[model samples]
Target: MNRSSCAIVYNGNLGSEKFLIQVRWLERTAREHGLHVQVIGNQELIPGIVDGSPVIKGRYEGQEPDFFLFWDKDIRLARHLEKMGFPLYNRASCIELCDDKIRTYEQLLNEGLRLPKTLIAPLIYETCEGIDERPYETIVQELGFPMVVKEAFGSFGEQVHLVRGWEELLPLVHRLKHRPHLFQELVKSSYGRDIRLQVVGDKVVAAMMRKSEHDFRANVTAGGRMAPYEPSEREREVAVTCARLLGADFAGVDLLFGEDGEPYVCEVNSNAHFKNIHDCTGVDVAARMLEHIMSKER
Candidate 1:
């Protein structure tokens, strides 16, 4: 029998154990499914344009894989691969939307998904002369103090900030004003806690409740602890819908709780790392994803 094949694309610069573990799990699972898997780094694939056509320079010793499991946020490379006729698990468009928090929210809101009240920061070009503090008062008046500020593009909750009062919000906004960002009304009820639901295809495969007593963010990379969680039907539906709406084949959807325990879309990760979820729930998300990929292959 001829086994199927795939290339798992990951970030070239990120050699951290957590990130590598995700790649390793996918490789292992792909082999178990009788797939010939080739691990690739995004940097290794050099993309270029020639004569109004997309071209790529890379090392693939064999014919193109059945699909590309893009685990990196390199949009250009992902797009190039798509143009080259290789199907990607989560398409380039999906990655682009998820990479920018503002875009993700806009798309989700368009579909009528529940989310925290948000205000987008105006764009500040590098050539712009000075900071505009005009929007500060209006933002504080709307979202009030103790709001959440997030860079449009970030991972592991590193670029997310919790600001209290006028003093703190001023400097942080000034610092991030040159970049894309958004301010959100803080979900006080879900402070220091949230649920992560891993969705593969149309189903919620694995879930975990994340808690952080020391920080306002519940991301595992931000020192949060994870516990196995069995989500309610409402939670499952919300997560699955978010993934489907985002055009993602697999996604990690974070849902923040409201005062009455309702779910609100925190953020959707098209290339979400699942090491913590695996360790917490032992669900083998990588295997499930590969199975989904193979099912789609048929």
Candidate 2:
């Protein structure tokens, strides 16, 4: 008999309390399944030499694991492992797609998935004095006031904002001028509320409804409360299809409600934290993900 083993890769800088909690849960769960789990940071795989080079001098010096339970957004390192012939759950491309909201929306739109009408903000160079507000003025004329402003690279609902008008929108534009972001038509029906369906492979393993009475964003980290949710067939299909199109082994799919109760893809997290969902619904996502990875490797 052979033992199955794998690695869990994470980012070193953003290893906060929640991140550590997720790591511990994964480590403990993997142990129960008779697997060797090595929790390593992205730095361990990429060395710091005088000139940038792909030299492995850290945890995985000369050998690669059978597979990886990748939970980080370090796409380069994830791709490096894939090049070494190690199968990664969710894969690098999936992570890359989910890491950027603009890119994710572009792909989702290309796939004909129903989603909020989003417009990518124009790129303003670093040397520019300030963004030309005329373009946004015209865009706002269409999207109207109270649009959703999202930084392409953000998480836990930190960079999401509800821009009411030019007063609020201009400040955000100046602040995030050099960064990649998008302006989305606000889903008033889904404001302060949404549904999260955790999909592992092709099946939705767990789900919960998140709502905030005081805030526009409903992320649990944003002080929103979660309740066990049973999505309708259409909702389930939308969530599952988004995950499949993104090529995710597992994903936390956030679906927003339209005026008529129609479901639209809000976001897809390739490596979404599952502890909150587990706490809310008592469905262990880590264990399921482990099983998914092992089954795929086999």
Query: Tens-digit lDDT track for model 1 on 120-176?
Result: 999889898688788878988999889999999999899999998888988888788
lDDT of 2 at 211: 99
Report per-prediction Cα RMSD to one decimal: 1.7, 2.4
Query: Top TM-score: which candidate number?
Result: 1
TM-score of each: 0.96, 0.94
Tell me the spans in candidate 1 whose CA falls farther than 4 Å from its real position: 1-3
| Displacement of the residue 63 alpha carbon in candidate 2, Å | 2.3
Winner by lDDT? 1
**Candidate 2 accuracy as lDDT:** 0.86
Candidate 2: deviation at residue 68, Å? 1.2
